[model samples]
Target: MTGNPTSRDYNKASVLDVLLSRAPLTRIELIELTGFSKSTVSRAVEELRADGCVVNGGVDEVTGRGRRSTYLDVPGTMGHVVGISFGMRTTCVLVADLRGRELRHVIVPTVDHQEVRNAAEWLVGLMAEASKSAEGPLRQVVVAVPGRVLGGTEIFGPAESMKVFAGPGLQRALADLVNAPVLLDSDANASLLEILTDDATLEDAALFSMSSSLSFASCIDRELLRRRTPAFGDIGVLFSGVGNEVLDGLLSTSGLLRFARGRGLDLERIDDLWLHPHEEVSRADVLDAFTTAMVTAVSAVAVTLDPGSVFFVGRLRPLVDEVLPEVRRRLDKSLATAPEVKAPTQVLGLSVARGAVYACLGMARDRLRDAVLEARRQGQHTEQSAPAF
Candidate 1:
């Protein structure tokens, strides 16, 4: 009403940001955190309900109030979220609930810098198959790419090469195929969000993804400090190398197979994983050199950011199940006391896709919080302006 954009939108948005970040809170709690009066909180809640943004949950038993203080939940039917992650030889797809829960996941084969058209078409087909099984309302789609993205935020997708996929290239392609509002992000950033949700140490931490093609980094928190900053060491080039010595050029299935052939091991003839797994890796003294690379990355992140924790994502987790031990062992050998090394392990085996779902959930119900605050403000004004004796 004041014609100033910051008027109530600011208050409403702050209120929503808090609510969505945590479970439901009573008006008293919201008032204390938001600095708004109980009257304002109540008005916002009522307005949210009217707008169909917040759901009227059942009673609150802990407070022992005479009447139930209506709890709030984001309207689940607002839309659908999808997550995609890619590597040199594999790709992952995930669907999530409005709350960001992974409803399902699918993994497929891929190639390096695979053709854009092939990737887009495959995504369309997968979503179609998923919709056949979906039972609830769906809208709003988000995508995660495994490179640095060119945008206001640099969560994952490689920031340098992402210019190729940025703007209309990917969003327009996906939108034309899926017919929904699409947002792109660095897949590693999405993975970081998934890990932060479960890793307590990650209350303030960073995740370094050591995968084929390129490595990515993400700093995590309940709230972003700088979102993406330079201090968070960038390691993409090291992963996707230029010549034969490149990590991606060595560890990728093709790379590994090439290395095996040079060592007289017929990788094409033998299913190395199922048959001679030992011979497949004994090509050189680099027994789990990738593990060392990952450990080195973690140690670097530790000394650099002193993040509460760090996680190793991508193919490294599965290949070297002993990654935590290996990382700690290396860190211990390097430092006098390794900053109280704790578990950097996580089960985001398919987290990027889950992050996509979370991105959507955060987007959909994310606004419910504002609607609640708006209602509370209106209620306060109504009561305050009433005639008094």
Candidate 2:
């Protein structure tokens, strides 16, 4: 038969999470904040300290106290984690502490974008320079790519995309270079997590990334939706036209430019749609088509996830003010219930990289808690197996 449920596990995790987020708390403060019994707080803190997960920060200064109290904190010397994002034109690397505070961040042009395999050495060199301030070996390294990552090894997308990770050698090289565990995630998925950090209201939402390829990440009840198919976010290639055309060819930045040219607007790039306001009348038709296609994809997401909110991320972010009204207008005419549409307010370059760092921080915290519990259990087993007195 199995032993009793690990019910106290919840309490331990709660206490540890608070400590990791805001440490150097006195016993009285922990007892008050955690709502745990005074004795329970003492015991938990003792066990955590014994496991080297928490350390005593000396006695707190008290002018009128009957007795000085000890403060406990998660030491900054615990370890560090790194998050990297590989985009179409640029690659961003971030080094952060276990608590997710940024120690360093660096952005560099992506070398040989079509052939990342040839630039593996350059990528490693960039990461090394970015992580120079790391106190010690990284606890985790999370890499976010513009394409889908399968089985933590293979990557799939357009031929000229982030296909370097499609092979296992690059992943292995990154792990070896950093001397840490590595995680691979889609850029859309990472961006989703980053958006949630700004507001607790976004428990469930969908992230629409309008980049080189159209992709999205859906979250339900604060948990990301995981799929087994690489085609889940391949909205770019989704069949649209009668014959050979696809969604990306109809609404992407490049696609909008092509549509404008067909209308004799003479626009060379998507940014021209906004940079030249005087030509707005000429490009109106192209904007209308762009908005229509974007709304159709968003409508599909709303029907599929019915999330509490839908966020616009990536390249299309700059076009939020220009297109939000149209997106809302279309959603109102189509859906029975349209979710709130939002654009990122924070200007953290490369949200995917920041999200990866956020995810790694969570993983590091959980692992540290598990290590403490395991150590405590072993200590108990040692006591039980000792010779009789």
Which candidate gets the maximum TM-score versus the true structure? 2
Q: Write the per-residue lDDT of candidate 1 for residues 20-41, one digit (tens) a residue.
A: 5553666667787889877766
**RMSD after Cα superposition, model 1:** 6.7
Q: Candidate 2, after superposition: displacement of residue 102 in Å?
A: 1.4
Residue 10: error of model 2 in Å?
A: 7.5
lDDT of 2: 0.70
- Lowest lDDT 10-residue stretch of candidate 2: 380-389
State the C-alpha lDDT per candidate. Answer: 0.54, 0.70
Query: Model 1 Cα displacement at 248 (Å)?
Result: 3.7
Tens-digit lDDT track of model 2 for 182-284: 7777777888888776567778788876666656688988888877877777777765432344667655555555667777886666677677763666666
